[model samples]
Structure formats: C-alpha cells, structure tokens
Target chain A: MSNQDQNLAATVNTTQGSYRVIVGRDVIDDLGTELQKTGLKGRAFLVVDEVMFPNPSRRAQEALERGGYETHVLALEIGEANKNLETVQIVYDWLADLLADRSDIVVAMGGGVTGDLVGFAAATWLRGVAVVHVPTSLAAMVDSSIGGKTGVNIPKGKNLLGAFHQPKLVLQDVGHLKSLPAREMSAGWAEAVKHGFILDAQLLDTFERLAPQMKALAGEEPVAAIRRSVAIKGEIVSADEFETGDHRVLLNYGHTIGHAIEKVSGYGTYLHGEAVAIGMMAAAGIAERLGMIDEELVDRQRRVLENYDLPVRASGLDVDALIEATKSDKKSRGGTIRWVLLEGPGKATTRRDVPEEVVREAVLAILD
Target chain B: MSNQDQNLAATVNTTQGSYRVIVGRDVIDDLGTELQKTGLKGRAFLVVDEVMFPNPSRRAQEALERGGYETHVLALEIGEANKNLETVQIVYDWLADLLADRSDIVVAMGGGVTGDLVGFAAATWLRGVAVVHVPTSLAAMVDSSIGGKTGVNIPKGKNLLGAFHQPKLVLQDVGHLKSLPAREMSAGWAEAVKHGFILDAQLLDTFERLAPQMKALAGEEPVAAIRRSVAIKGEIVSADEFETGDHRVLLNYGHTIGHAIEKVSGYGTYLHGEAVAIGMMAAAGIAERLGMIDEELVDRQRRVLENYDLPVRASGLDVDALIEATKSDKKSRGGTIRWVLLEGPGKATTRRDVPEEVVREAVLAILD
Candidate 1:
C-alpha cells in the first residue's frame, strides 16, 4: 500500500484501542469466535432490542455460551421514544444483580437503539468495560454501530447523556436484515447513499448499480456495498478524535435538517435515515442555490434515494419551525447551524455563513 | 531523580491531561483568574453544594463573572442517598436550559458527594465538558476531588453508576473548612492521615508536628500538608490509565471494609473518613496476624489517627455480616477481596489470599 493509503486506512483506534469492523452475510454466528480473537475470557452480558429477543439474540447468546462465555440475556423495550436514561437504568440493574465486573464484556444485539443504549451501559459500567455490537438493521450496519459514539437521550435532548466509548468490535451481519421491515430497509439505504455522496463517488455508483438488490437484501453485493459504507464511516470517525468534530462533521451531511424533521414530526413519524434522506435533499438544494454544485448532482442524490424508495420530499410541516429546530441541533454552534454540503460527488465541505433566505428557499424546495 | 525517587514522584498526568492541583487558604477566591489561565472563554455553570451557596459559591461566582464569564449558579442537595441518576437529571435539566455547549465548563463547588455527582454530570453532558472542582470539604479536596473517579450510588451498590472523568483543575481551598463542624473536620483528617499511612511517612510526621494547628484550622502547615496529599493522589491517579486500576488500588488502603461499613451502617451513620479510620485499624490487625506488618507499626497508625480525633475502632457491628459485605466491595475480584495492608508507614501492598478466619478476627478485634 502507498503511504497515503496507509494513513487513510481507518482502524477503530484511539486511547480506547484499535478494533476490527467485520462485515459479512452471517458474521453474527461468529460472535463467540470473534470475541475469542480479542482474547476475552469473561462472562457475556447480552442486552438485546425488544424486537430482536428470543431469535437472533438467542443465537448470539448461544454462540457466546458455546464459545465458553457464561452468558446472560436481557431484552429492553426500546425505540427513539424509549431511548433515554431510564433505559440505561434497566441495564445497570441487571449488571449489578450479576455482580458484573471489569472482566465482563457487554454484547448489544439489534439495531442502532440497542447498540447506542447498551454501548453506553458498557461505557460507564465499572467506569467502562469492553463492548461488541451485533448490528441487525441496515442503518446500524452502515452507521451507528461502527463509531465509538454511544449515548442515551434525555428529556432535554438526544444523546445528551453518554460517553465516547468504542466497541471492541462491530459485527455487521446482513443475514439479520431479512427480518426487518421494508421501510426500515429503505431508510438505511439513505445513509449508504449519503456516504457515497460525501466521500466516495465509486460507492455512489455501486449503490446505483445494485439498488434493487440492496433494497431487497438479496445477492452478495449487499454485503459488499454495506462493507464499503462501513469503511467510509470508519475513515471519517477515526479521522476525528472526540472534539472539534470537524473532520467527522462531513458525516453530518444531511443530519442538520434531518434531525429537525425528526423533531418537528415528533421523532415517531420518520425513521432516522428517512429524515436524513429528506435532509440530504434540502442540503443538496442549499448547495445548488450557492452554486457550490451543478443541478446534476442534486438530481443524482435524489435518483439514488428514489431507487431505494427513500423520500426526497417532506410536506405539510412548518418550514419555519424546521429552520428553528436546526438551530437547536447538536451540530449547531453559537446560534449558527454548520451545514455540510457537497461541491460535487465525493467532495463535502461545511459552511456556517449560509444566508437564512438561501436556506429557507432550499428547505422550501424539498417540502410539498 | 534517583531510580526510587522517579518511581514515586507522582504526577497528575494521564490521557485526561496533567492538571494543576492548587492547595491554598483562599484559592476559591482565585477561581475566575485560574479559569482564565486555562484559556477558557465560555460560560461557567457553577453547581455548588447546597450548604456552600450564598457565601463562598457567590464569591467564586463573582470571581468568574469578573473574569468575563457569564456564569449560572445551581445549588444541589447532594448526599449518598440522593446521589443517583435522578440527581444527575437535575443537572442535565439545568445545562439544557442554559444550552450549555462543550465550550462551557461545569464548576463543582462542594464536598465529595457534590464533586462526584457533578463530575459524573460533566462527564456525560455533551459527551463531556471540561470541569474544575472547587472542593469545599477537606475529605473532597484530599481524596475524591483530585481523582477522576466520579459516580452515583444505585440501589445495588455505591458508585455502581458513573465514569472516570478527571477535572481540568482541583482548587483545594482550606478557608471553607472554618464553617464545617468539628466532627466533620475530624472525618476529613481521616483521609489525610490514611494517605500518610499508605504512601508518605513524612506526611504522618508532619501531622504529628502540627496536630493542634490542623485540628484548630490555625496555620500555614495545614495548607502545605493538604498540598502533599493532593500531590500523592494526583500521582496515583495519573499513573494508571482507564483499565489497569492497579496503581490507583494502592490509594484504597482502608476503603475495602470502609465501604462495607458505610453500606452496613445504611450509608448514613459514619462519615467516609470515620469508617476508613476504623477499617485502617482492622487492616493493621490483619497485617499483624499475617506477619506482613508489626504491632508497633499498627500502634503508630492508631496514635496518628487519634491525634486528629479519628476513630480507630468501630464498635457493635455484626462481624460476619461485615465479612460478607467486604466480598461485595467494588475492589473484590472473582470472590477474592484484594486487601491493601501496610508493611510500614510508607509502604502498602495488596494481597488477595488473606484467609477468611484471619480477616474475621482482625475485624472482630475492633468491635465491641
């Protein structure tokens, strides 16, 4: 590999230690085997999403037990509404009952909510222990599970209570996607396409080429495509360490307005990636008005999202309220929203100086 | 530095950044000036102990406001029973109301309970904001405040929920001690004396030379003595990173049974330092029985603890229940209680193989 290539080679590394990101069809089955590679000899505390219990979670627990990890399983009733400090409390109670110590590893099996909540539990349990993610949803596979960012929302805001605890490994298994709803599948593809839009035009092409199969959760290309998204996210997350959040801000390409949509819709209407997909449309339009990109790229993002059945427009919501919500976003600073926009495919930059009228027009263009 | 000197020359340096531990008569008045030196230009969220409000907390607040910080003050009712996730939520609500960002620093102006609760709050708020500790109680300054270990007590155990979040600075101002009750003052000295028993024999000698002055809160030697304890804690905390808690374990000399006593007594009867003092006596007896320490060394420990009015014996407690409680201590490993015993005034070592009968006799010898 070239010297530059080596530097771009992202490893889940920091003071937290570098770890592997494995993506394949049935890597979930290798949960125990993978943990073995980490040389861990502790009891396994497996916490699963409510929907994921008694099936894939059992499979994971059995795998861990078979691999000599004395395993304990708990299923949490989790969703965006339920993702709060209260959920994290349930986990602490379970760990305390078992006298869970520093020698234990917590395994989170399910989607992003499960991963984020359990990941946080692992982060603060005994001031932190090892955690491994078995991400079942496509969105989790390509996004939340890979990064060390773990948190639970508070009444005040999302992820307001958490720590930057990296997992020992993230096992992105595509096999579990077969059981997910079609809407959730489409929501996930929004993120994969956004990743393609920001850092790799080649990834965008791969999505365009294999849109049907990825949406259907069919063929080997789905894993290959998911792996590429994993690589892109890994590269960005590793590039930034904790604060300044500048380099990784590129990953927020659609999240500014996306988060606002989730808020305005009361977090129950659209899935995270779906709101993000609509936000990407708003961002693409913002870039277009500023002449940062040609109209063709905007058309490209929309078409790719459409191919996966991702929404390109949000209607009947107050655009003014959505704009106000953007100011309240985590990426917002000192009353200015840092908007991540593309100059073209695979090239993104942030701007805090975008005029309010320009943003209003762009946001309005994506509504109704 | 010589080989031995270098090993023991403790520095408060770690991935959390080496910070200054300033111990003086009126460092609380210098709060704003010190924060300015750290190059922080953000709003100050000063969370004070309920007792410290309107007097010293206002003084610190005035200093910060004079130093050009837009400060907000919140007084919390913090104690062992109230130190839980519910208490942390109050802080979250305050920060969210202020829209406190990462640039803002949370100032914990309190004793160990306030520091631990607020420190845990700061560690998770926005995934961590810089925090400075203005420890009001002597116990906090010489012990809890300097170390990054922050947590809340859950239903199952003490500090069963928290994180290792080090402060940006620890201001150990002894001026605040003038307002504390004599009983509380005695409790605080227990920790300073324990530090002497575990690491520096010179500190013990200084305590003997200045017992009257320290007891009366009368002179400059108390400041110097407190500074030495802060340095010792800084060294031990920085020596260990997150996982290997081995070096920091040395600082837990009396806390094994100290913690159990606090738990067995329903967490309200003894001040932490009082329990540790009694625990220290029990530990000395254990070391004597095992031939790890001599009877003269045990007597020497008792005299120093007595000079400061710290209790050297705990009476009327169930000996067997206390033994069972020790097994549930945070420091226990795989059913083995890692016991830290003194070989001499300045030497402490841990032993996990101490027999149950030996431990029981040592514990019973201190009871009525």
Candidate 2:
C-alpha cells in the first residue's frame, strides 16, 4: 500500500529467481528493512572480508538483528590469492560445524573476491542455501555480484574452479563507494564504461558527461550510475543466463586482454578493472589494425577512459608473457584465442579466429 | 548396416541422450564395439584404478586403440580415500595440459571412486568435456555409474565435494565383475537389494529365487538381473535428476547410515556398498520397530542379504562414534538427520522428524 513497499514489490517481482541488482545511494542503511522481506527463518551468517568488517559488518549485523533476525559475522582474509580450494574447504567445514541450513542466509558483504568465494561456499554447502550479496566495491557492484558466476581462483587461472550459482539478491549501495579508495573507484568506473561501450551508446554519452562528478560524487550520481550499469548487465544475463551465445560473450569485450594482464601482473598487482581498462585499449588497437574500426574511433575511446584516470597501456610488461597467459584463459577453446573486438562505440563481437600476429601487434602497440 | 549396428540402434536411442546399459556376461568384450557407436573423435583418456589397471587396463586401452581411437591410460590410487580435491585438481590440470578438447572423451575405467573423480574432472574441465564410464566393479555398474552423480570425497564427508555431471555413455561391462573379490561382489549386490526394497518388489522376488546363483556367481550374473537393476536406477534418476524429490532420495534408502559407516571406518576400510549393507539392515530394523514395516518383511529382506554374505550387524563398531559420524553426513540438513525409511517392500520415504533416540535404538538392535 505504501510507496516504498510498491517499489520493493516491483523490484522483487522483476528479480524473482534471477538475482536483483539493487542500486541506490545509502542502500546499506536499508539492509535490515530489505532482508525482512526475504522471510527466511533462523539466524543469518554475515560473511564479510576482514578489511570491510570493522565498519560495514557491524552495521549490517546491527541492521539484521534490528529486523528481528539473529546474525553471526565471519570475517575472511581478503585478496584474489586467497581464493582457492583450501579456503573454500575451510568455509564449508565451518558452516557444516555451525549447522547453518537453508533457513539461514549468507550475506557476502565485500568486494568481488569475497562475494565470489562466499557465494560459491553458499551454493555448495548442503547442496545449496540462499545467499544475499552486498558488494561494497565498484567492480562487484556492476559486474561480479549480479551474474551468479561464483567460483574461486585456481593456480592455473582465475575462476578456473566455480559454478553458475545465482545470488538471492545483490544490494548495491553506492554509498559504500564514498569510502572506497580512489584507484578502486576508478576501476569500478571501467566496468560501467564497458556496459556503455557494449550495449548502450546513450549510457556512454551520459557517463562521459557525468564522469567528472562520478569521481567526486559524495553519493547521488554514482548510485544512479551503478543502477544503470547493473540493469544493462541483468538484461544481458536474463537473455542468456549461461554464456552460450554471442550477446553474453560481448560482455567480455575488454576481459580477454584484461584477464591476461591480471594473470601476468599477478592477480592483486593492478586491480582487475585497471587491467581491463588497458586491455580494452589494446583491443581497440587490434580492431583498428585489422581494419575493423577507424583509428580515430580508437583514439576517441582512449580519451574517454583517460578521463577516468584508468590505465590505457602496460609500459614495462613483457608482451610474450601476456600472450602466454592469454592462451590459458578460461574463455579460450581448443587452443584458439577468442577476442571480443569493437565494431564501433557501443558495439562488440567475438572473433575466435583473430590471428596470433594480430594479437601480438595489439600487445606491442599498447606497450608503446 | 552391420547386425551389431542395427542391434545397437534398436536397443538404444541416442536422440534423448539415452544409451545402452550393457548388463550380461562378457560385456567387457563389447566395450570397444560399443564405444565405436558414440562417434567420438580423438584419443580416449582411460582413467583406471591402480589395482584394476594392472590387469584390465592394458586390455581396455588396447581394445580402444585397436578400434582406431588413441588411448591415454591414467591410473589413480584405488579406493574412496583418494577421491578428494587434490585428485580432482591433478586430473583437471593434466587434461588441460594435455589439450583434451570437446572431441576427446575421458573413460572412467574403475570403481565408484574412479567414476566420481573422473566424472567431476570431465564436468569442470573446459566447462565440461565428454566422459564415458567403464565401471569395473558391480558396485559401480549397478549404482554409481548409472546415476550421473559424479563428485569427489571430502574430509568432512563422502561426496561432500562434487557435481551432478552425467557421463556421455556408461559402459557396464559385466565381464569386469569377474575380477571382483567375493566381498566386493556382495557389497555391490547390497545396492541391487536396496533397489528392491525401495521401489521394486519384483526385484526382491527375483533376488529371493536367484540368491544362491547370484552368490555363487559373485563375479558373474545373468544379463536379466543386471538389466533389471540398471533399469530401476535409470528410471529413478530420469524422474529426479537432482534428487529434488522422494524419487531420487529413495535410491539412498540405506545410504544415510551407510555414509556414516564409511566415514567412521575411514572410507577404504569398508567398500561403499558394504557400508550400505549394514546401513540397510539398521534402517529396516528401525522401520520394523517404528511399526512402519512388518517384522516378516524385514526378516525376508535379511534372509536375501544374508544369503550373499552381506553384513547385517554393525558389530565391533562403537555406537556413539557411528552416531557422531552420522551427524556429519551430507544428508543431514540443519543438524536434523534425514533417514530414508521403508514402510514395506518397494516402499520408501525420507523422514526428517525421526527422533535421534529411535535411530540410536535401531543401531543398538542391529549391533545386538
């Protein structure tokens, strides 16, 4: 009957079965209110990263308890390197011992790494239990927390061990971004920019206009920006929930090169989105060199990324190492490198037969 | 077309992803001939147990290669103890490093452990490649191989870590049973008896009539017996692929207590089906005592199992220890033990609300 309840009902209806990507300023403040709607009985397990728990974990626990739900917080070690089988086993064992059940929910409250590790643990524990994600970082807000691609990093590659287990809800409180480090904030913007480049030209234009304010946003615009980016991701995923089509693969436009960079640089060295920014530039160069896109268009795209202070090149990295890393990427099939090439702004396509020479040329050009 | 091709087509339909369940004497001799029908290209990754590989690995691999398919034999340490994350990771990495592609198929050529480990490897490698199962033991062919429930064991519980990955084809070569030790053969029969108790009174009647011959031919069975067992399992799994209902859980009639026994006995000490044999007797006693099933029916079931020399009593095992291990079972949800209890022959139900005291009393009775 109330205005707030009406909006909640609409969002809940749209997000049924598929995860809801709730983007708004100060959404963290509504954690208690929103979780009450899930109607799950018993205590909640709040699995938070050690880095975020001192501030946000307590707040979340307090909110859940206030909403008449019992809460227990489990703080985990942070970083991509910690995402492995050993950690997953430890978490599963802990939950098993704790007797956590389907009636209880796991709140994965951290960045992408934490959400992935926790979400996967939730998926596998007791066959499966409900998991709600409150992604605090930008990369997680727009991308990782929404798609339900949950897994840990194997020694061979990132997400080499995982499953397609969607979350119950994704609470993207852009207010959390106010506390995020500038570099991390910029990394998140790269993904938002990626959504714009891949599907919506108008989103790109709007992002360009508000790019400066996004960097300086206390709250309002960043929340709106995240909402738009999440909607784009949700629509694409809803169309092709599994990565069985080109539309889904197009979302990986900058990721092929980005994952290669992340692998070569060591997972935590550059931050995922930063590596992706540089990778996107490399992709643009590859497309232009192959006569798929105009050289001027490549420059225009670089300028937009530069405005956000995201990386556009890898200055000292070895091109050969990047090439080798790209070969082992999870996306590659039967030894062929699959690259997502830009046709123009707001358009991308997967090119599986892109010659190795073209990939090498693109790497070298980006290095220069 | 050759008579064999026409017979194969008539027996099995490939359109519904349905394949034959070869269940007769000398079935292993037909493995090479059967695999030819799958039209699989490239080499076969022959995964066998260390024990079985010594004798049958050479023959199996030779047969595959002789039929014009390359064969790469991989022998794993035998038993459930070896099924863990380390083994899964090693197998997956080996497959990736070996460049096994979609065209290639993995042959899980051992017992339940091999089927599970290799099946999981196939499911996760390159986001799933094809797998063919060559279950050497009765325990594997009669139950494990047909269900498509592939996964490795964890320290906390058996099959705590796994996936619901089905095999491309299951080669139930009855000839492999010739090599099974008497104890192992009896262990395998426990599951067939379980199928009888859970859903098929006709299977129970068949077992009663053929008990002597089935025991005498511990290493050999008439094609009819094997076919009946496989058909029962296949029909159950087809109805409930993910065990979301009573149809699939009924297949685990004796597994709840069986898993506990396996865990308490430290996995390899007792074969999986052996544990299930004891678990089944315990469950039957519980059902009888609860007045859910008639005592005469329990006696008849005991007579059939005893004829095969299967364990009916939980002797020399600490009751408290067994109870503690059962609490850690994967079947336990929210700390409540879910038991698949039988009301009568061919009737089973999962009861979550059964008191622990009742379970303890039945275990004690079985021990006596």
Candidate 3:
C-alpha cells in the first residue's frame, strides 16, 4: 500500500496455490500486524527448533497471540536426521491431541528441516491446514520456504518423499540469520550465490560487493541482496511450480552434483549448501570441458564460493558412486540426468547429453 | 472420437491436475490402446490386492507390456488394515529399488484402499508421478479414483493422513465387479445410491427400477448405472475438488455419521458402504426430525437401501462415541460438524446448526 511496503514484500503464484513473502526486521515484532494483513485466520500452533525454544520461539508465540490468535508453541531437535516421517508422526500426534481442525494454522518456526517436517504435517493434516512459515535460516528464508515443496526423507534417499504444498504466508525476519552457526550460515549463502550464478549478474555483483556485510548480517545491503535472491527464486518457481518443465530446472545450477554429493557423503556429513558449493565447482568444470564456458567463469564462480567461506572441493567421495547418485537424482527424467550448467554468468541451461565420463571427470576433479 | 467412446469415458478437472475416467468392458483388454491415447507414458509399476493378482493384475501387466511399456507387477494384501504407511513404505521401497525416475508411472490396480495407499505413494514418490488407477471395486471407480483423495489411516483415525493427489487416469472394467463379494457389491452401491439421493432424482429412479440387475452386476444396466454415478461424482468434484466448499460436501451425504459408525464399530466390523448405508438412514431420520423432508421420501430412501441388501441399521454401538467421532471427522471444520442432510430426494445441503441431541436421536433410531 505504501512505497516502503512494496519494497519489503514479494508474492509467489503457483498453480497449486499462492502466498506472500515479506522480508523485514519488523516482520517478527510486527508479526501480528503482518498476519492481519493476510487472508489467513486460525489458532496458531508454532513448531520451532529446540535451540530457539525460550527466545525467538517464545517471542513468535507472543507475537502470534498479539495478533488475536490462540497460539501454541513446541520445540524439537531438528536437523537432517530429524527430517523424516518419524518426526512428522510426532507433530501429527501432537496436533491430533490438541483437537486441531482445518481452520487451525501450523506456524513452522525453524530452518529447512523444520519447515519440511512441520510443513509436511500441515500439508496432510485434515487434508491440509494453513502453514505460515517463519524461516529462521538464510537457506529457508531465500529458497525452501518460498516454494510449496514440503516433504520428509526416507532411508531410501534424501527428499525422495515430499509434496508441493504451498504455504499461506512466509514472514521472514533477517535478524534471526545472525544466530545461525557459521557453517550453517555459509551453507545458506551457497544457495543464494547459486541464484546469482544462474539468474542475475547484478545479484552476483551485489553479493561480491556485499560479501562482508552479508556474512556479518550487517547493513541494508545484506537484506537487499537476500531480497534479490528471493525475487529470482520466486520468479522461477512461479514460472514452473512443478519441475515438469525446463524453466525451474535452471534453479538447480549446482544441485545435480550437489544432491549426489549429499547422498554419497551421507546427509549431515556435509551441509546441503556445502554439497552444492562443491557441486557448483563440478558443474563449472563440466561446462568448461564442454566449452560452454571458459575457465575464467568457472574460476570466478569458485571464488564466489570461497568469498562466503563455503567449500569449493569435496574430499574423498567415490566418483563412480557420485555419478550413480546423479542418475538417481529426482531431476533425472527417464534415467538420464538433466545437468543444469552455466553458459555464462546470469545464463543457465539444461542438458541431458552430458556423458557419464565427463561427469566422472568433473566429480573426480572436485574431490581433494 | 466416436459417440460410443464419448458414452464410455468421463473427464475430471481439478486445481491439482486433470484426468479421464473411462468405463468399459474392454478397458482392461484395451488398456494398451487407452494408455497410448493419453499423454502419460513410461515404465509401469502395478500394485493390486492379492486377490486380483493372478487375474486382473497379470492381465494388466500384459496389457501395459502390449502398449510398449516396460511393465512390473507386485501384489500386496491391501485392505483397510493394510492401508497404512507401512504398506506405503513397501511401495516406496519397491519403486526406489527399481530406480524409478520422474517420468515413470505407478498404476494402482484394485479398490479404494489400494487406490489410497498406492495413490499416496504415487503422490509423494519423486514429489509425485503419473498414477493410472484401474479400480476393481465400485466405490473406488465412482469416488476415490476421481477426486485425487489419496491417503492412509493412522491409529488416530481413518483417512487422517493423506493428500488430494489425483490419478492421471482411471480405467474401469465392470467385469471385475462381478467377482466382488456380495457384501462388497452392496457396500459400493450405497455410495452410488447416495449420489442419487443427494443429487439426482432421475438417477435415484434408475437405481430403484434396476436395483436387482445393478446388485447382480448384470447386463447393460450395471455399467450404465455406474457411469451415471461416475458422472455425478465428476460434476461435484469438478465444481469443488478439495471439498473446501459446499458442492463437494454434498457428496458426503451419509459420510458424517457413516464415518463415525465405521470409527466407533472399529473399521473392519462394518464395510465402508454398509456403514454409510446405515448413516444414510440415520440422516433420513434427522431430516425427518428437522422437518427438512417428509416421511414418504425417507421411507422411499430406506426401500432403496433394502432393495440392494445394504444395511439400513446398526447394532451394539455406543451412541456417545459415535457422536464424539462425528466431531472428530475430517469434515467437521471449526469443530462443528456440517451435516449434509436432504431437503428432498434430489437435494442436499449442509447445516452446522444441527443440535447434539438431534444427532443422538438419529443415531439411536438407526441402532437395532
């Protein structure tokens, strides 16, 4: 409604559903006001990481209560190990015990793991209830929270089970990013940087110039830079909500190798963004080998990872196992991996013809 | 393309996606032709109730193979008891073991439980794949297979965990219904009968006139009658796929009390349709008490259920638990049960203002 309001929020539209994403410091403090501005109304049940139990979690509860909702909060130890149906069952039992109905809302108040687990519970509970996300990590704020992709992993693989259930609203407060562990924060930045590599050169420049401020979680530049990343992701997902089309494939610039790396190394052994950081290096290598991009661009992309203190080389992963995992990645259609490769900064494309030997060499080169 | 083809197939459109339901005797034998006509294609994985294994399941595998698909068939003991996440896990494991990709298809080749469990697996596997349901039972062909309502039960209750993942296509072969146990046949007809009572007086007339043949799964009447039922369901779901609004709620005519009965009686004690048949009688009693419909229409509805050998009453049930379960039913939004009651034979409407005492009286009247 106002000039400042327009700049602080972005809306995502998907065939499944649509919702708004607002990025601001006041989002948490003014959570009540923000929700009142949206169409969703219900008793709020908040699930947060156990670490945030007494502070931001408690604060989020108070904020929801102030919005005139009957709010409840629970905290759990959430991470890659905790992001499975077993955790989902606990949330389901809790909601059932509380006599939750369809009009009730589940506010996922943690990172991607928390959002995936809690958001999944909300998606299937009573055939779906409104989920308002207060994503606490940079990875969640800029990427996972915006898309409706909600799921839990099985022993079979990572994210092998999930649904594209859009949230009712996403209210992210950047101040929470400061509390994330250094490794986790860097992992988050890796995804944001991937957005720059695949979509926007200006965003790449912004990240390069504001790397220090962004890392420190200081100044307006970090927020502005994060917003650009969010905007690019929002646009891409809006264009292709389901990865049935090629449009959304570009967003996976580094995820082909990244996901394979996560699988081969075992989840939690390497953070998701950390895996992607190394994967990005491998993708660049493949692109350079194919002459799609020069070594200069590949080297430049590697420097971007280094700038954020993200890993550029994965150590000791079996190259054959990694190649096998890539073919098994969800993005592979008809058993052929559609590699998301960069032709240049701000330009990305998909190809299924990447030879297995080329992939093997790229993966092998990335390992120390 | 031909009038004969038009008469056999009905199409469904939902916010999630759209698919077609083709009812024909040759559906199984012509499965190859039907699948090729649709856009879906890939390797086929079919899961059926163990009873359908040697016959329909084997025939389906052959049909798919004929259509140039790399086909695989695995049978499971799918029923209300088997329709849990554990079964879903088995399917997930099987697909994962087969190295299933995004483009592959999973075909559910049995009744409602088979559709729900396999459908939920299809919905979540690789974030969803194309599922073609060859529903062997009457209720599944008319209801579950069209709406994309896929889920399994938890200890908390029936259908408490699921999603609205629509089937890519539903191909029904009426010949299979002939093999259904007498009680199963009666139970399914209860749903088709419900469609008539709530939405179409003409359909109600057709069922009343041809009740014997429909029950016997005899002649052209059974197939014609089933198609009419499918059409009614298609129309209702197309208008409101999620049951978020009034149109789809009307389809839940007897489900409110029926679900409670199923829950209170313990699931296997009452076939879903039998419980719904009794629920329909209870609803008729409620409508009579509320002065929404006269005794003549109520008596006529009772005769329809009796003609089909469907149960019109229940025995040895706790009225209190039944009432409690209704409040817990998925349709009870905001903690108030929106009872779908009939104004007359051809009309249904929702009312949240039904008194607790009134419902108790209805339940008591229907208990032997």
Error of 2 at A162 (Å): 2.5
Q: Residue B145, candidate 2: how far off, in angstroms? A: 2.4
Who wins the DockQ comparison?
1
Per-residue alpha-carbon lDDT of candidate 2 for residues A1-368, written as tens digits (9 for 90 to 100): 11233122113222226444566665666676677776666678888888886787887788788878888888889677788878888777877667676567888999998988888777666445778999999889888888777877676555666655667777766668778999998998999899888788888887888888878874456556667788788878787766767667888878888988887776678888899999999899889988999988788789889999998988778899999988877677767877989888788888877888988999898885
DockQ of each: 0.72, 0.23, 0.68
Task: Please write out the lDDT profile of model 1 over residues A1-368, one tens digit for every residue.
Answer: 11222212235766677877888766667778778888888899999887887887887888787788999999888887888877888999999999899889999988898888898888888888899988898888888887788888987788887788888878766789989999999988888899999989898898998887777767777777887888888877777857476778898889999999999988779999999999999999999999999999999889989999989999889999999999888877678888999999988999999999999999999999
Ranking by DockQ: 1, 3, 2
**What are the per-model C-alpha RMSD values against the true structure?**
4.1, 4.0, 2.2
Model 1: residue B158 alpha-carbon error in angstroms: 1.9
Better of 1 and 2 by TM-score: 1
Cα lDDT, all candidates: 0.85, 0.76, 0.85
On DockQ, who's better, 2 or 3?
3
Compose the digit string of candidate 1's lDDT tens values, residues B130-176. Answer: 99998888898888887788888887777877788888877767789
Ordered by TM-score, highest first, the candidates read 3, 1, 2
How high is the lDDT of residue B91 in model 1? 94
Name the weakest run of 10 consecutive residues (lDDT summed) in model 2 chain A.
Answer: A1-10
Q: State the lDDT of candidate 3 residue by residue for B1-368, as single tens digits.
A: 22338555578888766777888675687676677777667888888889998887888888888888888888899888777888899999999888787778899999899998898899888777888899999889877788888888778766778877887778888888878888888888899999999999999999999987787776778888889899889888889988877899898889889999988887789998999999999998998999999999989999999999998999999999999988878777776788999999879998889999999998899987
Give residue A200's error in model 1 in angstroms: 1.1
| Error at A188, model 3, angstroms | 1.4
Clash pairs for candidate 1: none
Residue-level error in angstroms, candidate 3, position A88: 1.2
